[model samples]
Target: MSGPFVYVPPVNPVNYPPSPVHYHNSPYLASFYTDPNSPFIPPLSLSGNASPYQSPNTLNSPLPTVLTPNAVPFPASSSGSAFAPENPWNRERRVSWNGSVAAPTVPNSSWLQPPMYHYRRRSDAAAFPFQQPVDWTSLSPYAPYRTELVQQSFIHPLLNAEDRRNDLILDMSCPSFAPMRNIGNNQTAPITPEELNQLAFYPQAYGAHIYCELIPDLPIDIRYRPLPGYSPIAPPLKVGDILAAIWNDMQLGISQEMWASLDENRELMISRAYTKRCKIWASRGFPSMRNAGVKKVDCLLGKVFFRGLVPTGDEANTLRMIVA
Candidate 1:
């Protein structure tokens, strides 16, 4: 409970009229004042023993405002529920303090928190939402690496390297002089290291050609198998045909000679007239010769293939096959 007042008139009443009156009338005020340490005392009664402050019907009624014994009682004319409010500052401060105490209890007042700061969490451990896991089939360090085996009967190095060393040529070829062979693996003198490497990379047609050369007595019937499920031989044998077949088996590497030979057959050749207008086009690198460039280069190479200096047919087949 708040301390009780003693009656005392303000010296400067015009300026400090709201000061507590306890100092002006302590003796009378003390008689009614609630003691700081004592249990509450009921208000004085109209009857000798009946308490006036204990009426159940008037429990919620406004309590009387106390005044000092020496001071004149002011008429009850104020509109405020709180007693002794003399200035707007005290009234406003009480209203503000009450509002602050109630703020957390009101659901509608949740706007007191900033919207952007609400529900925010640190993203230090967040992962990229769209990131895919690494592929272990492509990244496994101990995965086996396979070495390719060249087929014995194919003509081109590129073709030979694609198929394992199984060929009808070696199976049917004569064991005598001019026997069909498996290129570098033929029973002959040691092939040069360079040729051995080439043999390793040769396609079917070149492999067959190498086989034929290694064993001169090898029969032509042994060189290539008939197409699957039929007895028909692979196709009409031409040096360019063998070269083209082998060329098909390559990844992207094509020999200049084979490319030129390919031009004679494909008819997509480079012409002097076209190159003269574009020297840069003429001097471009071999791999770059593709599409329109391939056509142009083929035209130029075809002319050289048909020149009198180059022989045609099986007689010149060896030279044509090798150079290409």
Candidate 2:
């Protein structure tokens, strides 16, 4: 009680019994007393100067000293903190944003030459072949008719020459010369030979026959006709004369000079020639050109032969016509 009071926990009787217990009548005397057979108990002390008892093993061992931030020694290269110079083993390898290993910082290194890229040159032999030159004369309206005759001479083994020629002429006749079929009935009355012969005088029909020979693949409804109100400004020629000129020009190739002379008025000349022909056919007691439902067929023959003319208002709405 003379020094600072130290709390001592009561010894557990089950774990650390001081001595054997005995029954005694005297209340003042302790019921438990130290027995000679029991283990010895050390006396407790309360003195200020006395040291706490320790086991021999603990007394012989050195105590561990706690490290403080300032007391801790760092590597020579470090800043004397927990964040020391990074260990070479723990240092992360540098990489590029593209996931490639970054190049070393050393300049002009042996491995640092610019990347090699190879490009193959194209060979002259591999180049595309030039197309064969087109024959402008072959596009003439009479070309197919002439070709048919030539082909017939070689190929017709069954028919006699006279019979073959007659058949060819009959086949070459334009379908436009035939009478219009009734819409309600598929059957058409057979044409008399006289009617077919009389219809031959019409230049429009004749032109159509030639035009059909020129472009057999064109639909019957879309076969050629003259533009509505065209008139020849330069060389004033009749319909028959114009037709003859065209046929002759086709036989002998059209000259650049002729085209240059015609200039912007070529379409007008072509149109006027066709219009005059249609008028002549109409005046001669032949069915009027308008009666043949030819209004929709305003394609000029000159327009078909020429290239790069601006499309008319009506033509602009339709797909472009491909020149032969």
Best by TM-score: 2
Alpha carbon deviation, residue 321, candidate 2 (Å): 17
**C-alpha lDDT values of all predictions:** 0.29, 0.29
How do the residues 1-324 of candidate 2 rate in per-residue lDDT, one tens digit apiece?
589877654432221111212211111111111121011112334564454342212444434335442233344536554335555456687854777787765434324444444434447634646644455554432322222332111111111122222221111112121221122223223223332222211112222122223333332222222333432232211222222222222322233454455556644664564465456556645445544322212233423231111112353112122222
Residue 181 displacement in candidate 2 (angstroms): 21
- Clash total of candidate 2: 0
Residue range with the least summed lDDT across 10 consecutive positions in model 1: 170-179
lDDT of candidate 1 at residue 261, scale 0 to 100: 55
Please provide, for model 1 over 118-215, each residue's C-alpha lDDT reduced to its tens digit, 9 standing for 90 to 100. Answer: 33344853666665655545543334445577432223322232234422121010111111223333222221223222322122222233222221
lDDT of 2: 0.29
